[model samples]
Target: MADNNNYRDTTHQSDLSISITPAKAGVGLLFAGGALTMHRILCLSALLMGLFSAVGVYAADAQQSEPVDPGIEGSAIDKSAKEKSDSGGSSFAVWESKYFASSPDNTGPAVEQPIEFPHFRHAGDHDKGGMEINCMYCHTYARRSLVAGIPPVQKCVGCHQSIESVRDKPRIKKLFEYWDAKKAIPWKKVHDLPDFVRFSHERHIQRFIFQLNRPVQEVCGYCHGDVKTMTVARRQKLLSMGFCVTCHEVKHPVTAEGGTPIGDQAYWYSMRKPIIDASGIIKAQGPNDCSVCHK
Candidate 1:
């Protein structure tokens, strides 16, 4: 009887140990799951806080007024508005000039370039510090290509290397740095047109500069503004459909002063063919048809 009782006691002790072991494992699992849940909640809270902070910062920035940089000129809207008001033009005139004139926003935002090339120093009038370099000398492709190609770095260094006077200048130093590194000066395009718009710099250059014999500066100015006076080039003209259409609608003289008829020297798209009016003067209009430009 004593042996049997001892055997029963050992079995009961073993069973109790097994039951307690399972309870402890269940408690541990519960604690681990709770901890995981708490961690996820904390992470979600942090993400929300970050998102809210970003939104608040954006709102604050949106409300704040942008400070004008002295180096950059004011937008065309501001200049035209003031000019119209000064001239005693009506509000409608001011509105029209601001939106529909040569450019809606002349002199666009100043694009920060690798080197701040001083257009005034290079292209400005001889009375000023400008070298009076011809536009064609650097932009050689304007008359020959669809796009006015950016000049290679070698072209700039070729001339700059000989000019020892301004070699030490900061801008020139930067130019040399790029040359030494064998990198192209990444010029930012200020007059960026939309991808869909088709513009042929060659056609315009051939017609105005070669055939019409218009001043290079004046012809370029019709779209680029007075870049000769600019430090860094900016979009001085609007280049909008309205600006283009306005010029196209007008009937311009087909011949230059010497009566050199604007024959099919260059393929120019026009709504109507060159016509001889009652005054015996040949006149041609620019492309007014959608297909001529849209394609």
Candidate 2:
């Protein structure tokens, strides 16, 4: 009987030990799992740090690259002229190159338009069988508005309907189809800037055209290349920050000594107010403030 009682006591103790074993094992497993998770997190952080360091080095190399000059890259102006002519336009006209930078490398991809408007026929030199129409005649808003808005269909129809010359032309026929459909032609934007950038065509037009009394073509050529020679308008200038900054750094006479009045003082204010000199001349460069272009 004592032997049987001792056997029962041993069985009970064994059951109790078996029940407690899982709880101790669970605590140990939880600690081990946490250590493994921490190790994985540290490895991930090191990988991310390595990736960021590589990006920093690449950005540094890009920053050290040579700067682009506003002027065309050539030993002589004649060579530069030949380069421009070979790209798409005629021989280098000083009017086209005067205020803007032009290079074959800077030309943008040719964009396909809904109706291939013949700019060369309309705005090119009169000697080349062109009408020699002023740019402002079609793009009327450049002087007053922020954007040089596209002309309405009616504007084109007004002249085209009256003139029978080239009415049967394929491009003109496509234009007429849009007019008959009573739908606006979805002309693709050729020169597009980032959403963050704010450019005022009105401000530039006013300064270069009205205030400076520069030829409209020369002034417009500062951003857009010689459009007169192109069949369809294409981006010919770089239109980058470097291009703009290069032009802005060069000092321009604010008022050309009774040539054109600056008009309202408030209208001419850009990043900073212009300073008048002892010779009664207002000479200043373009707005260089970050807030001016970054808006």
Candidate 3:
């Protein structure tokens, strides 16, 4: 009996030490499973990151070493011109605001010319630190060509050769440098039109200005603003088709007594569309012909 009781006690102690409660066993199993799952997820994430990094490095290296396609480089200007010519000229000549120029180039709205050519000083009052120079004298081609050509350095040196007062001035000194080198001043072109649009200075000069015998300022002010005041030139006109069309549609009244003026250029633009003879009868007239502008 003693031996049996001792055996029972030993068995009971072993059970107490080895056997776990149901809640504790379940918690242990859950912790172990969670640990295994987290380990798998972390290993997978590391592998994916390595693959992505290698791909990114390879892509960067390929991009830096590769040459761009050759055909894309030279086709831009040609394509642009072809489109414009095909369209038979768009009325919106200077569409982009940043592209517009009056007197061109520089960081801001005002461009510092190679020589700081002061329009205000040259164009303003003679008594007020001004020479009051005539614009046509400098822009000789304004009366003749589509381009109002920049005056040659020789033209500038002509008068400047005798003027002793401002010879050492920095702007004047720079002028002398170009003159000495016999190089063009590389004057920036202010007014630039697109490839398709064709504007004739001769036609406008002959038709509206010379025919009407108007003031030079009023005549040029149709496109160029009152440049007499501005030190640096700026584009004032919109130069759009609508603005031009409005000008064409408006008439200049006859200034003399007992006189009737012709009603704008649009009236006479047609080819016998509204035919009228000198004897008392008036016919239809208007100037909305596309061919007149777009050729």
User: In lDDT terms, how accurate is model 2?
Assistant: 0.61
Superposed by TM-score, candidate 3 places the C-alpha of residue 123 at a distance from the truth, in angstroms, of 2.0
Stretches of model 1 off by over 4 angstroms after superposition: 1-107, 252-285
Q: Residue 179 of model 3: what lDDT? A: 96
lDDT of 3: 0.52
Model 1 scores a C-alpha lDDT of 0.60
- For model 2, residues 1-295, the per-residue Cα lDDT tens digits are 1111111111122233344455545544555555555787765655555455545544433432223232321122233323333442321233224333455556667789899889989888899988989899998999899788899999999999987988899988988999999889888887787777788899889977898677787678668768899988988776777566544533322332332334644335442334455555553434534567778
Query: lDDT (0-100) at residue 88 of candidate 1?
Result: 32
Residue lDDT tens for model 1, 1-295 = 1111111111122233344454555554555555555787765655555555555544433433233222222232234334433443243333434543445355467688878888888888999978888888888899998787878999999999999998999989989999999999999888887777888899889977898777787777677867899888877666777567544533232332233334754325443445555566554445533555665
Q: All models: lDDT?
A: 0.60, 0.61, 0.52
As for candidate 1, its clashing pairs are 103-238
RMSD of each: 29.4, 27.2, 32.5
lDDT of 3 at 247: 41
User: Candidate 3's residue-wise lDDT over 146-194, tens digit each?
Assistant: 7667899999999998999989988789999999999999776555555
Better of 1 and 3 by lDDT: 1
